[model samples]
Target chain A: MTSWQIIILASIAVFALKLAGYLVPPSLLERPRPARIANLMTVALLAALIVVQTLGAGTRIVFDARVPALIVAAGLLAVRAPFIVVVAAAATTAALIRLLT
Target chain B: MSTARSSQHKAAIRASVAVGIAVSAYGISFGALAVTAGLDIVQTCVLSLLMFSGGSQFAVIGILASGGTAAGVAAIASSTLLGTRNALYAIRMAPVVGGRWPRTLLAAHWTIDESTAVSAAQTTPEGQRAGFWWTGAIIYLGWNLATLIGALIGNLLGDVSQYGLDAAAAAAFLGLIWPRLKSMQPIAVAVGAAVVAALLTPALPPGLPVLAAALVAVVVGLTNWLGPKDPLPAMQQLDLGEDGFP
Candidate 1:
């Protein structure tokens, strides 16, 4: 597919996705099951996504110094360090790893 | 008369822009990387603008580069699945919008993970609504602009892998998820998913394992197999007080 086609398709898909939110009756959101699913889904999906992004890139875990960055990021997060710090620790760790290895 | 409320909103706008700038910088890396992966500049920018979801975009390009049609579908499916979480957030935020259609429209447009977190953390209703709208808008604008800029510069950037830009997107995702592990259940889910995905990384494509992991998370959550002792007390109580920002 051409770039335009991909863009158009994806845009339409996203709009449709957003529309679901607007169209759903607010009452449904009040239910315990749906609310439970919503809250759990964020953490669940996020965790899952991070795993795929970090470890699964076509094969073999890319566990080099990058893993250490995650370790530090998790540690900072554990301490409830500021958001900026957590991000910086990860980015800086990765950057240093790239520079060194 | 609520000067504090107005000021907090102002701070949210600025913070959103900051996040926008940071997140958009990665777009340059993505754009540059996509070009190297056989995507023309236009294709790269289009993915950024329309899909607007980083994980899925990376999955699509990665699959296409590897000649994997299924990869594209898997990536899109997983992304849409993850993106669905934003819809739930929208539902939660709706009441705070106070039935203002125009504001809702804008809120709907800009709603994303980062903006939602900020808005959800606000203590007041007005603050929540304002934070949601302003943050979402600024991030959206910044992200698109960054994508365009990144695409333009991508042609000039050679071998981004040397700088580890290839993994930068993943690294950013780590930053996003790390802050959310507030309890044992979340941490366990994260570790479990990561280990499983890592184990399956070689057997699967870039995005499939992620989709699988998400499925696992949902199942685990549904079964209540393990995790914190259900902090969601009064799950349906709608006590706007506790809802007053986490």
Candidate 2:
């Protein structure tokens, strides 16, 4: 499938999951395992994404400007900076690091 | 509507608009990142409009940007896995979004973290519904609009890597994950999964590492090995055996 097809397919699949929840038996909610696992997977997957996007270039893992940028991002987040600030700071930090080194 | 309901509606609208604007402003980052991830402006906008789930949309673009579709269906799998939380959200939101057919369908689309959170914060049933509807509407509009704006800006800024948009993508993920890292188990999930995925990245294919690392989370989560020592009350624990797989 093309990129468009892939994106659309994903959208439909996710929407279907959401719609199914409304239609399905609420008894599923009684079982906390599935929901908890889902939550846990979200956390895990996101953390993994951070690692991949920061360190991986294609299949090769290269430590570069992104590491300090990510550290800055984490620091900004720790200080309760707004979302946009955190993101922009990360980008700027990386750009500056690359420019200098 | 009674005076109380009307007041509740007013309050919900106020709260929703505030959060909606703040969160939607961040959509620009997503838009910029998605386009940097190889999606066109149209594709980026369509994604936010349709998927409307921040984490899942990021997953889609993140995968696409790195290895293209050559990653072998990992994009869809990871994106859908993230969207699974919306299904769980819908369970809590069904009654708040109570209705039939088209209305319910729309509610499902809006059954996301922000709207659910706004609704859950309310004390009254009316307030909950009002919060859900208001937050969903504002966020839907603001998020899509901001996505368009970001996509346009991203298009103008060629060669995104020099601008560090790649790092911005990772930072975006960190931003999303930050709030959830409150407990030992979740912290363990993040640290373990990150290290494992990092370790596996060199050996495995582009996307496989992340997927494989998710197993670590499943193991840690299922075992509850690092979770709080305080047990669930007996009634809740009745079903969970020693293995704690369930």
Candidate 3:
């Protein structure tokens, strides 16, 4: 399928998912187990995304500029730096590493 | 309206607008990175408009950038999985946005993190409505405009890696989810998932590792359910007062 088709289908799916939330019985959502999983899903998926983006390159895990940049980002985040600062710091760290090397 | 009530409403508006502008700064990066990641200007804008969720859009683009063989499928799956949280958000927002189907549908379209956070922060239903609509409108406008500007700039400055825009995707993702790691359980879950994905990258396909990592959450969730009762973690509390900025 083409990119546009993929986007269109995904758009419909997303809207359906959002709308389903309103339709689902509150009893299901209020359950402790599903709620717990839903909460952790964000953290887990994001972590997986970060790991893949930073370390993976076409099925090979390699260390590169993103590793240090991510370290800087994690540190800034640990300190509760503003969102903009975290992005700028990470980008600058990666850019400077690339420049120096 | 009374002066005090008017002041409170004004404060909610100011807060919502501030969140909108702050969120838009990330949109500029998303726009530029999406183009660099092989999406056209129109595709990027449409993704932002329809998918309408930053994390999911970034996930899709990130998969594409990583050279996934089935990039489209991977993108959609990851995006769909990441978007499930919006359903949870909608559950919390349903009571607050009670109206006819048309209004509720519009509210559902706007049921994103920032809008939900701002609306949940309000004390009154009116203020909640104000917060939700204003944040949604400003973010929609600001995000699309920034996306256009960034895409134009990115298209002009081809080969975005020279400026380290390549790493911007990961950086942006980190910036987004970092604030939510307020407690140990979430941190542990993130660490565990990262480890699982890192280990699985060599053996599995591009997207499967991410999907596989979700099992860790499922296991944890199930264990929590079967085990003795424990206090709710910060993440599960859904306290908007501490949600901070978008």
Candidate 4:
């Protein structure tokens, strides 16, 4: 399939998944375990994304500016800095580091 | 009605708008990155409009960028998996977003992280409604608009990496999940999954590593080992201040 086909098909599938939740029998979801698992799965996926974005370099793990920059972002988040602040600071930190080295 | 109650709703709405604006600004990064990742300006905006979930949107671009054209299936699978939480969120919000089929259908489109966090933060049903709809509408409008702007800007940039776009993406994902790390169990799950994914990144394809890492959450969550005595989904206890910003 072409890029357009892939994107269009994926978008529709995601929407359908979202709608399925609303239409499903609440009794099945009410079990709580499924909900718990779903929530945990989200965390897991996000954590994986963070690692991949920051370190993974196409089948190779390369240490680079993103590591220190991510740490800076974490520090800001720890202090309760706003969302935009963390993101901007991270980007700026990486940019500065890359420029210097 | 009590003035206090009205004020409560007002606060929720205010926060919703603030979150809307904040989350919407992040769309610029996505727009720029998506364009740089080979998606045209129109495709970028279409994604923001249709998928509507930030994590899923980012995953599509990120996977495609990493694994090249052959990674199309992985991109779709990873993006869909990311949307799983939204589906779960829908089940939780069904009662909160009650209406006819039409309204609920529309609500499903807006069933995203920021709206859910803001709504769950409220003390009253009216406040929840206000928070959900207001945040959803603001983000929906602002994200699409910002995507266009970012796409335009991305066309001018030479290299996104020099400007730390990659780092920003990582930081954004980190910040998004930061709020959900309320306890030891989820923290362990997050760390476990990260390690697993990192280890598998060199071995498996781009998107498969993320899918593989999901087992960490499933096993830990199912076993209830290193979990809380009361197994709550954590959505009901969402503190809006720390929630994953869309």
- Candidate number with greatest TM-score: 2
| Ranking of predictions according to lDDT | 4, 2, 3, 1
TM-score of 2: 0.93
User: Could you give candidate 3's per-residue lDDT for residues A22-62 as a string of tens digits?
Assistant: 88766666566766777678778888989998988889999
Candidate 3 residue pairs in clash (backbone atoms < 3 Å): none
Is 3 or 4 the stronger prediction by DockQ? 4
- The DockQ of predicted model 4 stands at 0.67
lDDT of each: 0.59, 0.83, 0.78, 0.83
Q: Give the per-prediction TM-score of chain B.
A: 0.76, 0.91, 0.91, 0.90
Candidate 4 on B1-246: residue-level lDDT in tens?
Answer: 799889988998898888899789888878887877778888888988988998888888877767765778888887887788788777767889868989998899999888888888888998988888999999999999998998888778758788987888788788878988988878999999999999999899787898898898889868877776875545553344534667
Residue lDDT tens for model 2, B1-246: 599888888888888887788889888999998888888999999999999998888888888888786763788888888788788778778877869898998999998888877777777898899889998999899999999999998888879789999999999999888877877877889999999889988898777888887787678757776765663432232221111100
Q: Which runs of model 3 end up more than 4 angstroms from their true locations?
A: B1-4, B225-228, B231-236, B240-246
Predicted structure with the largest DockQ when compared to the true one: 4
Stretches > 4 Å off in candidate 2: B229-246
TM-score for all models, in order of appearance:
0.73, 0.93, 0.92, 0.91
| lDDT of residue B105 for candidate 3 | 87
lDDT of 3 by residue, B116-212 (tens): 8888788877788788889888988888888888777778778855667666677778876777677777788888899999999999888788888
TM-score of chain A of 3: 0.89
Model 4 ranges with Cα > 4 A deviation: B2-12, B233-242
* Span of 10 residues, lowest total lDDT, candidate 2 chain B: B237-246
Residue A21 lDDT in model 1? Answer: 69
